[model samples]
Target: MRVLVAEDEQDLADLVATGLRRHAMAVDVVYDGTAASERLAVHDYDVLVLDRDLPGVHGDQICQDLVGVGARTRILMLTAAASVPERVAGLGLGADDYLPKPFDYSELVARVQALGRRSQAPVPPTLRRHGIVMDTQRLQVTRDGRFLRLSLKEYAVLEVLMRADGAVVSAERLLESAWDEHTDPFTTVVRVIISRLRAKLGDPPCVHTVPGAGYVL
Candidate 1:
């Protein structure tokens, strides 16, 4: 899943972004509404964690604008206001979900994950292909019943390919879904990760490069 976190509180924003990344979600953070708008315009994010009182261009407007344009990005608005009316207002502005501040971290993660799922075509939590089995809920992967140890990035890339169900997936698509904005477009990061993944998945080499096209599993 790819996520954008728009929060004016630097510490809170960084914390949320880092935690989401640990869950194998590609995340980008902006400290203000203006920067958030800029990033939103450029990236096709699956979810947006927006603070309702964002500086520069209130989060309400951002949510409304995105909904107005029919963007598929799911919005989860956050605020310190715990009142019922406040949440109603946020949702009325087009937020898909709303969470009050001082919320439990686990709940926030669950909400984001749930929203991410809504943003994309439905897929089973457990993916099976080419003798490889991925239990997304447990963050576990096994090939022919042999459990595989993979880094977060490796797991994310593998998920994207497995979800493709034998269709070719380009390097650019992998980067977009598995990496944040900070990654260089020309970097060999995807290839390096793919190499590591192939080694871990072992023999029979199901992952294949299609030369000028992309990769397939």
Candidate 2:
């Protein structure tokens, strides 16, 4: 899943982004609403972790603008206000979900995961294909019941490929979904990761490279 975190609190924003990345989700962090708007306009994010009160553009207006444009990005409005009225107001402003401040890290991850699923076609928490099994909830992967140790990038790329269900996933798409905004578009890191992933999966390789296209499993 690709996520855009728009929080004015720099520390919190970085913390959340780091946590999400550890779970193999490509995440972009922005401290202001303007940056958030720019990222939203340019990327097809599956979820937006937006702080309700933001400077420069205001998160409420950002949500309104996204709704106006009919964007599919799922919004999880966040703030310190834990009142029922506040949550209802945030939802009324077009946020798909709401979470208050000082929340549990696990719950935050769960909420993001839930919103991500709602943003696209429903998919099981555990994805299985070929001889590979991915338990997303546990961040575990196995092939033929043999555990596979993979880095965050490798795991993210593998998850993207497996989610394709054998359909070829373009390199551009893979990069978009597996890496953050800091990644260089022309970098060969995707190829490098795929090569490593193929090796880790062992014999009877499941990841196949399409000469003129991309990769499939």
Candidate 3:
């Protein structure tokens, strides 16, 4: 999933971005609401982790604006306010979920994943094709019953290709969805990741390259 994290606390935002990246999500962080608005206008994110009290524009306005624009991105308000009124206010502003600050990281992840699911068009929990199986909820992938050990990037690239269901997925699209904003668009990073992913998936050579076009599985 691609996510936008709008939090003024740089350290906390960085930490959350790192944790989400470890789980193979494409994350972008902005320190203030204006930057958040800029990124939101540019990228089609699946989820937005917003801090209610933001400097430039205030997270409440961001949430309300997102709703006004009819964006499919699910909003999860993350703030230090734990009062009932605060939670109600956040939700009333169009947040899909709310989590008080000092929250458990695992719970945050679960909530983000849930919101991500809600944002996307529904697909099966486990995706299977050509003897390969991907259990998204369990983060497990197996081919003909043999488990595959894949790094986070490898797993992410494979997931994107497999989800394509044999349709061509361009390298640009892959980069946009699997990597963060820091990735160089001109780099061969997507090629390298796909090469490694294929090697790990092994034998059958399901993944294929279509020169001048894209890749298919």
**Best of the candidates, lDDT:** 1
Clashes of 3: 0
Clashing pairs in 1: none
- Model 2 Cα lDDT, one tens digit per residue, 108-128: 999998888888777798999
Between prediction 2 and prediction 3, the one with superior lDDT is 2
For residues 1-217, write the lDDT of model 3, one tens digit per residue. Answer: 8899999999999999999988889999999999999999988899999999999999999999999999999999999998999999899989999999999999999999899888876778899988999988778899999999988888888888878888899998898778889899999998898888788778889889999889999
After the best TM-score superposition of candidate 3, give how far the Cα of residue 107 lies from its true spot, in angstroms.
Answer: 0.5
Q: For model 1, how does the per-residue alpha-carbon lDDT over 149-181 read when each residue is reduced to its tens digit?
A: 999999999999998888899999999999999
The reply for model 2, stretches above 4 Å from the true place, is none
Shift in Å, residue 76, candidate 3: 0.6
Residue 44 in model 1: shift from native, Å? 0.5
- The candidate with the higher TM-score, 2 or 3, is 2
Give the worst 10-residue stretch by lDDT in candidate 2: 114-123
lDDT of each: 0.93, 0.92, 0.91
Highest TM-score scorer: 1
Which residue pairs of candidate 2 clash? none
